[model samples]
Target: MPFVDLETNLPASRFSEDFLKKLASTTAAALGKPVDRMVVLVKPDLPLFIFGSSAPCVVLSVAGIGVTDTAEKNRDNSATIFPFLTKELGLSEDRIVIRFSPLEPWQVGKNGTVVTFL
Candidate 1:
């Protein structure tokens, strides 16, 4: 599974499920994975404080089996994710932070069992 958990301090805007769907599709294409397996969680309007200042900031974590397997792949993923944050979320690229966690199938769980077994 390709799972993205995105948390933003910025207040919610006119975001809809359509935006998430689009993001999933973009992620799937970038990772060369099936679009139907993408899962994105967006949490906005959260009270986030950094450097004693209240500004628009986003912290996103992406975890999957093979998405972040290599440096080159990470670069490829960022190329697609960064621009979308600026254009769709209105956050400056610098204010956005993305962390990639590449998981082995056994490290993930699914339906009360390990993903690898499935």
Candidate 2:
């Protein structure tokens, strides 16, 4: 399975299903995998702060928003994501870093209530 998770400091409306489907297709083609076998998650948050000069590096802390996790696919999805965001959302590639995490289902809770992964 080729799983892609997108975390951005933008509006969720910026990512539509059609855009995601196309992204999935592109990702599958890049990875030489089937589209049906791919999964993607889109998360939108506030903007990011990047450091360094050339090859601008992103500053990460224990407390940060927009994090994603993938499983059993290409390791460099950021390469694909950046272009997609630029073309689709009109975002700039500079000072942007799309970090990846290995995917694992977890029992989540909010407002003192456990939520279902399903």
Candidate 3:
């Protein structure tokens, strides 16, 4: 499973109903994971600042087991995600930060148990 959390200073009006679904799909494709197992959260209209400005900015965190296990894999994932965010949000690449967390199976829980058990 892949989990994606997006926190943005932009308003909710900036997003369509399908935005999260599309993001989840893109992230799943980028990570080579199943979209059905993706969990995505989006928090918009939050107080965020970048370079001391309250402009539109996003902190996107993606986590999964083995998906971001290497620098090269992270770079490859960012290559796909960064541009998609820029185009969809109408923000500059510099205004968005994508953090990739390589998680261990034991660190994640699912179906009332640890992922390692699944």
Return the top candidate by TM-score: 3
TM-score of each: 0.88, 0.54, 0.95
CA shift of 90, model 2, Å: 0.9
The candidates, ranked best first by TM-score, are 3, 1, 2
Worst 10 residues of 1 by lDDT: 48-57
When 2 and 3 are scored with TM-score, the better candidate is: 3
Q: What is the lDDT of residue 33 in candidate 1?
A: 87
After superposition, the stretches of candidate 2 with alpha carbons farther than 4 Å from their true spots are 46-48, 52-81, 99-118
Which portions of model 1 show Cα errors greater than 4 Å?
Answer: 50-53
Top lDDT prediction, candidate number: 3
> Per-residue CA lDDT of candidate 1, range 48-117, in tens?
7654556888887888897788899999999998888788887788788889989999998889999989
lDDT of 3 by residue, 84-110 (tens): 999899999989999999999999988
Please provide, for model 2 over 1-117, each residue's C-alpha lDDT reduced to its tens digit, 9 standing for 90 to 100: 545666555666766889789877866665566778666676666454455443322221111111233433334545655675567666567755655443333433435654333
Each model's lDDT:
0.83, 0.53, 0.92
